[model samples]
Target: MNENKTHDLEKERQYYTNQTKELLQNLKEINEQKELTESELREQVMARIGAEKQLQAAEKALEHLEMALKMTGAQMTELQEHIMPDVHKLREYFEQCAQEAQLEANRAGIMRQAIYARK
Candidate 1:
């Protein structure tokens, strides 16, 4: 009977050892899955940060372009104001030249008529 009890105790010990090994394996698998999940979360966070930075850069570029366009428009208006007086002066000069040319032609025609009558 003592030998039978000893044999039963040995079997119980073996069963407990096998259960411990199975539990350890299950814990290792759980830890591996957790590590993979953490890595994926980190990657997602990095991607979001990069995208936000790109959006901010685009916004800043657009602001600069708008400012430049406004400056160009203002310059065009100033140039037009400066050139208006020159355009008026040129028109006045052209009118004066036309009047002088007409007077010269009349004087030449009167001289020709006087010479022909004397002959």
Candidate 2:
């Protein structure tokens, strides 16, 4: 009877050892799965941050373009105002020159007639 009790106790010890090994394996698998999930979450967060940075850059570019366009429009208006007086002055000078040329031509014609009459 003492030998049977010893054999039964040995069997119980072996069964407990097998159960502990299986539980450790299950725990290891859970830990690996958690690590993989954490890695994926980190990748997604980095991608979102990069996208946000790109959006900010695009917004800044748009603002710069808008300011440049406004400045160009104002400069165009100023140039138009600055050039109008010069255009009017140029037109008046051309008319005066045309009148002087016509008067010189008339005088030359009269001189030619007088020379022919004298001949």
Candidate 3:
């Protein structure tokens, strides 16, 4: 079924694109925030690394399945549906962490200014 195969390929491509978009969106936001402390930077880096690993694993799984599809007719729909929610949660959690870190940095900056103004 050429049509079915074509459709599956399209879906797989779309999922990968979505993952990349989420990863990049969060990274951009974190980077644009003021300078982060060591632990804050580590948190962002860990989140980014986790996202990247997921993407790489998905890519590898897709490649393996593409090859196996010829022999097994396996479908990727199940994997896509199952993982989407978890990915969304992960993205949200990372965004929250970044926002918290940014807020803390802003407060610290304000405190520094206040102390300096008094001096």
lDDT (CA) per prediction = 0.63, 0.63, 0.62
Candidate 1 wrong stretches, greater than 4 Å = 70-119
lDDT tens digits, residue span 1-119, model 1 = 99999999999999999999999999898778666655665565566456556555655655565455456665577764665455456546545654554565455456555544544
Clashing pairs in 2: none
TM-scores, each model vs. reference: 0.53, 0.53, 0.39
The regions of model 3 sitting more than 4 angstroms off are 1-74
* Candidate no. 1 TM-score: 0.53
Model 3: lDDT of residue 8 = 100
Cα error of candidate 3 at position 70, Å: 20
Candidate 3 positional error at 107, Å: 0.5
Task: Kindly provide the TM-score of model 2 when superposed on the true structure, using C-alpha atoms.
Answer: 0.53
Q: 1, model 2: CA deviation in Å?
A: 2.3
Q: Ranking under lDDT, best-scoring first?
A: 2, 1, 3
**Cα lDDT for residue 1, candidate 2:** 100
C-alpha RMSD (angstroms) for model 2: 38.9
